[model samples]
Target: MQTSLAKSVTFNGVGLHSGAPVRMRLHPADADHGIVFRRIDVIGMQNRVHATWDRVTPSKLCTLIENEDGVTVSTIEHITAALAGCGVHNALIEIDGPEVPIMDGSSAPFVAGIRRSGIRFLRAPLRAIRILKPVEFKDGVATARLEPADGFEIDFAIDFTDAAIGQQSKRLEMANGAFVRELMECRTFCRQADVDHMQAHGLALGGTYENAIVFDGDKVLSPGGLRRPDEAVRHKMLDALGDLSLAGAPILGRYVGNRAGHAMTNRLLRALFAQPDAFEYVTLDADQERLLPGAGVCRPVALAG
Candidate 1:
């Protein structure tokens, strides 16, 4: 069955890039509402930004969505991923700024909020996107592809020259609350050089060692340490799930990403839509529905990673 949040939940924090404090809330919506962002700060314009592939604007650092009126919400990947992680399909996300708060640089905080507010199943049947054929997109060496699969899964690989974060690969079958248990708490990571560069360009102004894993070659610079052994790769898979949720429906496919980020994932969605025969919308069978990302995710406990 489709579901929505049982009650509204609120969050307040500073934007990672903008460095401006913001507030956001998630309100339960009707069955087919999908996920839509409302800019409460916009006085007299169409403030609704549908979390859909067509609305995505190009950005490497984060997943951004813009409406026809040019209203936008930046850094939505974590929230979107949290929604997917909880299996909450229809939500009206209200925000008071142009960007969502970058809470802890991971979906853990959002996951905690959603679990606390709980979920209410709707009466409507669920719909999902089932890949009929493989669709691939590439930019330089980075690539993203989706192929037919009975259940949702992610296989990702990342390679960095920095010794601290060299080549890492992971394959996850996102079933039975695998997202919450295996991927939710992994924080975003960046090299010290990248942080220096982003700060020089007036970006990552809100970034701190507290929120992200800052690593130098062969060294972890963040205060504590990694939440898990391969946190970087797990976080990439988490990001992929969030970006894929923007397709406006659950996808039953094997997503393979090789050093791919937000832009490449968005482009992959565009390519999927461009090819009519590559995918199809379907009402899932009992077995298939049970094999999706948020299966049995009723309570967001301290799941083992």
Candidate 2:
């Protein structure tokens, strides 16, 4: 069965890059509505932007979506991850600004909010994009791939030049609330040099030691260090899940990424859909539905310390 939020939930914070104060509300929508973002700040224009891959604009730092009217919402990956992680199929996400709040730089806060508000099932049958064949895309050292699988699973690998965050890899089946429990709290990270560069370019204006993990050479600069040893790779998986959700439906496939980012993942999706024989849409059975990422989630355990 498809699901929506039981009630509306609101969040307030600052955008990581723009440093603009913003508020957003997640409201329940009827079944089949899918996920849409409404730019409440815009008037007399098409304020609604579908959270689909085709709407994605070219961006290096985050996942950004824009409408035909040029109204855009940036850095949406965290909240999108939370929505998909919690099994939310339909929602009208209203934002008063151009970006979602960078709450703790991870999906944990959004996960907590959704768990608190709870979820309600709808009477519509759930549809899922099931990969039938392997689809791959690559750019230099970066690569992303998706292949047929029984359930949604993610495997990611990231390598950084800094000694503090060298090479890390992790693979997990995104069932039984694994995303919320394991990946939600892993904050976004960057090297000290990158932070300096972004600041010089007037980017990451809201970034501080508190919102993101920053490392300098061998020193850990982000206050308490890491929540997990391999947090970098885990956060990459979190990002991949969020980007994949733009498919406008839950996906049943195994995703593998090696140094892949938003643009690479979007390209991989384009490749997947371009080959008609590569994928198929299917109505899930009761048992299959139960095993889906959004079905077996254990909210309490997911948010527990």
Candidate 3:
């Protein structure tokens, strides 16, 4: 069955890149609405931005979506991940600014909020993109691929020059609320040099040690250090799930990402959808539904962890 939130939930915080304060509300929508973002502050322009891969623009820093009228919203991956992770398919996300909040640089707050609001199941049967064959996209050292699988799985590998975060890899079957329990709290991280470079260019204005994990040479700059030793890679997996959610449906496949980012993942989606033989849409049966990412997700219990 499809699902929507039981009630509206609101969040307030600053954007990691723009540093602008924004308030966003997630309202339950009718079945099959998927996910749409409304720019409440815009006037005289189309304010609706569909959270789809086709709407994705080329961005190095974040996942951005723009409507035909040029209304855009940035840094949407975290909240998007939370929605998909919680199995909320029909939502109208309203934001009063150009970017979603970077609350704690993780999807924990969003997950918590959704859990509090609860999810209501609809009568409509759920549909998912089932991978038919291997589809892959690559750029230099980065690559992302999807292949036929019984359920959604994620495998990620990240290598960084920083000694504190050299090389890490992890693979997880995203069933059974694994996303919320194991991955949602992992925050975005960067090296001190990258932070300095972005700051010199007047970017990441709202970024501070409090919001993101920062590392310098061999020292950890963020207070209390990392929540997980391999947080960098786990966050990468979190990002992969969010970007893949742009498919606009729950995907049943094994996703493998190697040093892949937003742009690369979007390209992978483009490649997958462009090839008709690569995938197919199927209505899930009751047993198949149990294996989907949203199935068996103990929202309240997962959030507690």
Candidate 4:
């Protein structure tokens, strides 16, 4: 069955890149409404942006989508991840700004809000993209690939020179509330030098020690360092899930990323669709539905101890 929120949920915060204050609300939609983002602040142009791979614009920093009229929204990964992780099929995200708020740099706040708003099942069948062949995209050292799998899975690896986050890798079956328990609270991280560079360039202006994990040489500059020893990689996996959600349906495939970021994942999606033989859309069966990321997950749980 497809699902939608039972009521509206609202969020307020600053955009990680723009540093602008924004108000966003998630409202329930009818079945097949999919996920559409409306720019409430836009005056007259087409304000509705569909959350789909084809709508993604190239950005090295975060996932961004634009409507035909050139209205765009950035940093939407967290909330989209929350929706996909919760098995929501349709929603209308209304935002009075150009970016979704950073919100502690994690999806936990979104997940918690979604759980509190509750999920209402729509009387319609759910569909998923089933990988039929391996599809991969690569740029320099970064790579993103998708291959056949019985259930959704994510395997990610990251290597950085900073001693605080040198090398990390993790793989998990993202089903049965695994995203909520394992990945939702992992915060976005960046090296101190990168933060300085981005801020100098008028980007990541809203990023603070409170919202994003900051690494300086061998030290974690964020307070209460290291939620998990492999948080950097886990967050990468969380990000991959968000980018994949842009596919517009649940995916029954294993995604593997190596130093991959938003752009590479979007490229992989383009590659997958370019060759129709790579994937097929199918109405999910009971067994297949149970294997999806949000299967049987009713409420958010406390972070693992």
Candidate 5:
């Protein structure tokens, strides 16, 4: 069955790049609504931007979606990941700003909000984009690929020169609340030098030591350090799931990312759809539905990263 939120939930925070304070709400929608973002601040023209792969436009360091009328929303990955991980297929997201709030630089807050709001299963049947063959996209050293799998899974690897976040890899089956338990609390990470460079250029204005994990050479500048030893890679997988959700349906496949970012994953989705034979939409059987990312997930007593 398809699922939507039982009641509306709200979030307030500042945009990571723009540093503007923002308010956003997630409301339940009819089955098949997928996920749509409405820019309430836009006075006229088409304000609704569908969260689909084709609507994705290149942005710096975050996933961005734009409408034909030029309305855009940036830094949506964390919220979208929360939705996907909660098994939410239909939602109407209304925001009064151009960017989704970067709440704690991770999807945990969103996940908690969704769980609190509760999930309402729709009467409509659930469907998923099942990978039929391998589809891959590469940009220099970074790559993203989707291949046949019984359930959604992620294999990601990252190698950074910063000793605190040096080479790390992780693979996980996303079903059975694995995302909430293992990935949701893993915050975004960046090198201290990169943070300095981006800030000097007037970017990441809302970033603080509390939200993102800041690594300075051999040390972690973030106060609490990592929630898990392999947190960086797990956060990458969290991002990949959020980006993959842009396919506009649940996906049943194995996603492999080698230092892949938002752009590479979006390109991989384009590649997957470009070749019709690479994937197909299928109505999910009960057994198959049980294999998806958020099957049977309930509000967590405590989040583990």
Candidate 6:
């Protein structure tokens, strides 16, 4: 069955990139509505942006979507990931700003809010995209690909110059609440040098040790140390789940990423759709639906250890 939030849930925080205070609300939508973002801040014009690959706009750090009127919202990957992980088929995300709140730089807050609001089943059936052939995208050394699989899976690998995050790899079948229990709370991270570079260029004004895990050489600058030894890679997998959500439905395939970022994943989607023979839409059978992430998920657990 298709699902959505039982009611509206509100979130207030600063945007990670814009650093501006914003208020966003997630409201349940009718079946087939998909996920649409509304820029309530827009005046006297159309302000609806669909959370899909076709609506995506190029951004260096995060996933961004825009409508024809140029109404855009940035940094939506986390919440989008949460929605997909929770098996929410449709929602209307209303934000009175140009970006979604960053919250704690993880999808946990969104997941918790959604759990509190609860889940509502829709009368319509759920559909998913099936990979009929492999599609790969490469950007220099970074790469992402999608290949046929019985269920959704993610295989990710990352290598960083910082000894603190030298090399990490992880793979998971994103089903049976694995996304919620394992990947949901992993926070976005960056090297201290990169943070300094961003700040030098007048960016990441709202970033702090609390929201993002910062690494400097071999030391973790964040006061809390590490949530998990392999958190950096877990966060990458978390990000992959969120980025893949832009496909507009659950995907029955294996996603593999190597040092990939938001842009590369978006480009991978473009490649998938470009080759019409690469994928096809189908309504998932009960067994197939049970294999998708959040198929049996309910509420989120505690984020604090």
Q: Which residue runs of candidate 3 sit more than 4 Å off their true CA positions?
A: 298-305
| Residues 1-305, model 6: lDDT tens digits | 67888889999999887789999999988888999999988998899999999999999988989889888988899999999988887899999998888888889999999888878877788889999999999989999999999999999999998999999999999989899999999999998888999988988878899999999999999998988899999999998898899998899999999999998999999999999999999997789888998887864222211
Each model's lDDT comes to 0.91, 0.90, 0.90, 0.91, 0.91, 0.90
Candidate 2 colliding pairs, count: 0
**TM-score of model number 5:** 0.97
Poorest 10 consecutive residues by lDDT, candidate 6: 296-305
Candidate 1 structure quality by residue, lDDT tens digits, 97-125:
99899889999999999999888877788
Tens digit of lDDT per residue, candidate 5, span 1-305? Answer: 88888889999999999899999999989888899999999996999999999999998699999999999999999999999998889999999999999989999999999999888878889989999999999889988899999999999999898888889999999989899999999999898889999999999999998989999999999998889998889999999999999999999999999989999999999999899989999999889988988888844232111
Give the clash total for candidate 1: 0
**For model 4, how many clashes?**
0
Give stretches of model 6 more than 4 Å off: 299-305
True lDDT of residue 26, candidate 6: 96
Q: Please, what are the lDDT tens digits per residue for candidate 2 over residues 186-273? A: 9999888999999899999999889999989877799988999999899999999999999988899999999999999999998988
Q: Each candidate: RMSD to true structure?
A: 3.7, 3.5, 3.2, 4.0, 3.8, 4.0
Off by over 4 Å in 4: 299-305
The stretch of ten residues in a row with the least summed lDDT in candidate 3 is 296-305
1-305: candidate 4 lDDT, tens digit per residue:
78888889999999999989999999989888899999999987899999999999988899999989999999989888888888887999999999999999999999999989878877788999999999999889888999999899999999999988998999999988899999999999999999999999999999999999999999999999989999999999889988999998999999999999999999999999999999999998888898988876654232211
Candidate 6, position 291, lDDT: 92
Candidate 1 weakest ten by summed lDDT: 296-305
Off by over 4 Å in 1: 299-305
Q: List the residue pairs that clash in candidate 5.
A: none
